[model samples]
Target: MTEPPQTAEPSPPSGAAPAPGPAPGVTADGGPSPQAPAAVRRRAVLAGTAVSVLLILAIVFGSRLLRDFDSALLPYAVATVFLAFGVAYRYTVWISAPGARRLFRQGWRSFFSAANFRRAPTALPRMIATYLGFQKFLGARSHARWAAHQLLFWGCLLAAAITFPLTWGWFTFTSATGSGPGYEMRIWGFEIIGFDALGFLGWLMFHGLDIAAVLVIAGAAYFLWRRMKDRGAITGQRFAYDLVPLIALVVISVTGLLLTFSSIFLHGGGYQFLAVLHMVSVVFTLIYIPFGKFFHIVQRPAAVGMQLFKYTSRRTGEGEGEVLVCRRCHEPIDTAPYVANLRGTMRDLDLGFDEWAEYCPRCKRVLRGAAYLDHVKKGFK
Candidate 1:
């Protein structure tokens, strides 16, 4: 256990030991004593409250004390507040777990360490590009899956960039010449640019949401098709957890596009209805983010830090030629520090088989099979 950094944000009482914080819920006597449910809830409440308050303040200040705020988008803004609260609450509860807590500490602790950057400066940036940005891990599964995921990720990102600011009143659009073809865009009560409403740039600017919606629909539709048709996907499918997110995206996108279609093609007929429908769908998704599979979006970036931690740890040990190998296959499984962290996490999890982390996956499975046969088959006789 290394001494924790001085500025341990959200510190969990990590002492002056020469290591990461105490294992998930480690007792002073070196045994797992899982976190109390009440304590976890308390932490979650604090996190949620802090986040909600910060976001609310940002909304207030960024909107110039409601000067630019739109009353019509009030419900959307409220839903986003709830979204922030829920995500913080769930994230706090999740990291309270032994394994998750350890990893969380390890990832962040390594992140703040100056030694990590001194060894390899570009390591973090390279990983963010590959792991979080490109999501190359998904490509290992299938190219189609990777493509669909990229579309979905970028679509959601684009939609969020446009939607959240607009809803919070940080973004505003006004006619430059009293509702003429020229228009001006403003963010936080400051003019960004002026453009012709009939020009290509204006078309792209005004229709950005439509483009994002189309991307979302395409990506989600592909996934929905796969889930319905693929045998393997069907075996692990859950309607609410998996399918509903995609379905909700489709509904929101389709309704949003219909809103544009109604204005452009139907002379504003059914515009109000489509707008309400779109709002409802967007509201539902925002509220659903923390509790549903969308939580993975928040969790994924933090995992990139873990990859950096592992990388730097190994590089730090390169000169020593120290590598942790599988107990059976003798193949390198992970860096010594990483494996030690894993075993510590297992111990914190109250999983007695911490030694299992030392073995390769194939050897673990083989041992499991042998044990099952020996114990069960012998017991039956």
Candidate 2:
């Protein structure tokens, strides 16, 4: 009988070092042999701290600019410009990029394709999943966190959408009876929607907004504290992006809550000042949205759409061969370099002539072939 072909030796266990003993000061688990220098970490923390301080200053002073604008028209114009620029930037970077656009197309195809529709059957379940799984769909955070974020995100969006049309009288659908169609529609819709009972809804929405604001502010604050306390969480480079939105959100939330609840507490002449301050916060937030993390609002959805389209296209065979699968985990590997490395490692490992399969190094499980193929179809370039 022919001898079995010689099999390569298995790789050393992941945590095992080649040497007989751990390297000097190295952990037994074979993690990095050297810790980052304490001085370097300290500097990083200090830098993040400074950026956080500057961000706070910017928001505090930026809102003041809105207070000085005497004509209400200019603030609205500024807000519109900011919103436009933000949308344009995100589109160009994420939605219009060649790779991203391809993915976006696939997403649209997937949504409109008969196969997907037949598989899903009802639109309501898909809609509910979309609503509840926003963060998961975006790959941003968990469901609960995403839900909290959506409350603030949609609230702000809805508020802005309604405010603009109602305040500017933009729609032409209503009778041209001197009173703007937009205004008439707003009143009609509000009444018909039982906004007369909006007291409860308003309270709920505002409370939700307040909670979201707190969460965002708390996250920022934690980052800031980490910069000061832990020193490991920051890169030390101070960019406007680092803390500006955090400060802005905090300002907006505090002022908004005050405007609604504490307006009566303002002393003598302080009422006017407080009212102006509150409005200034609103205006500043509107203006800042385009320039900050808030810009993610537009970019995220497009990203999701692009992802969907990319998956659909691959499923339809508009691209290359079978998607790469992880040999160790048996799962589909994306174009990620690390994943490629894992596959290469698995192929090098002689595993008793079983067909090559993708696998997750972390879990070390052989992913189902069909599932792996599906993943590749969705994410492979």
**CA shift at 266, candidate 1, in angstroms?**
1.2
Deviation from native of the Cα of residue 131 in model 1, angstroms:
1.9
Give, for candidate 1, the lowest lDDT window spanning 10 residues: 24-33
Task: Report the lDDT of model 1 for residue 65.
Answer: 99
lDDT of 1 by residue, 19-101 (tens): 74423322322111345498888888899999999999999999999998999999999999999998898888878887778
lDDT string, candidate 2, 161-256, tens digits: 544543232311232344422222223223222221235654453355455555555555554554456544344423345456556666766665
Q: Candidate 1, TM-score vs. the true structure?
A: 0.85
Please list all clashing residue pairs in model 1, or write none if there are none. 1-17, 1-18, 1-19, 2-18, 2-19
- Full-model lDDT for every candidate: 0.86, 0.48
Task: Superpose all Cα atoms of candidate 2 onto the true structure and report the RMSD in Å to 1 decimal.
Answer: 15.1
Off by over 4 Å in 2: 1-74, 121-134, 137-190, 194-232, 236-239, 267-269, 310-331, 334-381
Number of the top-ranking candidate, with lDDT as the measure: 1
